[model samples]
Target: MSTVGKRGASSPRELTRIKDRLSFIYLERCVVHREDNAITATDADGITHIPSATIGTLLLGPGTKVTHQAMSVLGETGAGVIWVGERGVRFYAGGRGLTRSSALVEAQAMAWANRRTRLKVARDMYRMRFPGDDPSGRTRQELLSMEGRRLKECYRRESARTGVPWRRREYSPDDFTAGDAPNQAITAAAQCMYGIAHSVVAALGCSPGLGFIHSGHERSFVLDIADLYKTDVAIPVAFDTVAESEIDVATRTRRNLRDRINSTRLLDRCVNDIKELLDHTEDDDLNDQVLLETDGDIRLDSGRNYGDELSW
Candidate 1:
């Protein structure tokens, strides 16, 4: 009983294997749990395993595996995992000194600037595409303009509330391993931003690797879109949560904040916004079939599809 797509087929042997190894993990709000770890999934069924090593700040979904080798493989694939729930997952990897407070501030500031730029671009595109239309078009254009303004205002207010000065400068792309505490925080915040970007690209049916702004990487587009959301969404959420709690920047509380960023309703709101943007796009093509890891079978509306039907 695996999810597949129409015109797709599942392999009987693979399906069985996946089903035997089936395990489900759930993370809601910043809490992670094994929903059904003991359940045996066959080869065809997909089971996501989170490495115990990265549990504090990160949570992987059911289709992933916990092994170091698996993680390396995933990173190589350029396909990132997303936590679909309210809180985005956060984790510190490789003992990199934590992100600096200033770095976090810088990241947020940059995010605000990026969001403003993108909104203006989007509005301009709309105006150029629908020139000389009726009042409806004009009204739509006004709404778009207003949305940009509102987002900018929100960024300003949030920055003030977080007590982080709005530094008007470009953020240097330093390695995560070199980040101090504040830098680590920035990285965590960026991870949430990336999640939003990934979701938007997914909804748009565009390759996250292929980006409009960011280039030369897997899911570069996602990275670009995520850059827009960090200041408006992820930054504010992370900053406010930390500030309100009066959590010590050096303590476990900061980690707690990072892990649970997705739990905030703000993250969910961003996801919804991404979905809406994608809905308005012209392309309607998407592959919704769920692949069964247990038996290498796919579930579609009509019936199970086998793996042999796949192109590769």
Candidate 2:
């Protein structure tokens, strides 16, 4: 059995139910304003009520207009808000997230900022994408090359499986019209994955630039996480979209991706995967900078006692 959430009832179960029902809320060419604890959108069609609390994410696509009040409410309620471009819902910018802890963020940063530890975490990431396989003795580069080869073979298999023409990965952000059907579908699928991935990363309070396998960009972490499911999620969706030969690849890709993400429980999986990669036990704390959250603040986890506070 499932439950539906009202305006003020967005418990964990209710939120999961919402994702099960409406994967995400896509807003475009509308003015969004606050309505009580919810939000309303007015467009050429009509007014519609949005239970922001129940939503997993609010993607602000092209032509979307949001008022300050609405933004404030969404932030306060901890909704994932993403600003996307017209081309395949490219994630351009983002707003506040729903993460309740800075401890996770600190842990991620410490893991990524270190050298030896970063390699360990990166190996764990590759291991996550390919479970039941032993890559324990292999280095990061070897694992990367292996994953690349697997992906190349996957594309070939999918091309034959779906009968969609597959040449190579071609993309140009400035010109989306230049790409062919498969290319367009690929971009559409990747962007959709990125949007969803961005929400999960943000919701975990993880920095999008601090990446294990990627570096030197603001969205490095986002790309790194999104790539983990590219072969399984985006590749299949893109190929299927191309096989359908849909005139609107983005729309069809979004539809398929929503269903896939929901079915896979990608949001929750992303959170757990991140923690698994960076998580350490009592024996292996990094840099002596271990941290924890107590009542919403990040503090050193070292078991040291500072005597009772005295007047300074």
User: RMSDs, each prediction?
Assistant: 14.6, 6.6
Clash counts for the predictions, in order: 80, 0
Query: lDDT of candidate 2?
Result: 0.74
lDDT of 1: 0.39
Please report the TM-score between candidate 1 and the true structure.
0.39
Local accuracy of candidate 2 as per-residue lDDT tens digits, 193-307 = 7877777777667798898888999988888888888888888988887788758887787787878888888776666677677793222211224353444453546567645
Off by over 4 Å in 2: 1-23, 280-312
Q: Against the true structure, what is each candidate's TM-score?
A: 0.39, 0.82
Could you say which candidate leads in lDDT?
A: 2
| lDDT (CA) per prediction | 0.39, 0.74
Q: What lDDT tens digits, residue by residue, belong to model 1 across residues 78-131?
A: 223344322223422211111111222222233334755445434443433234
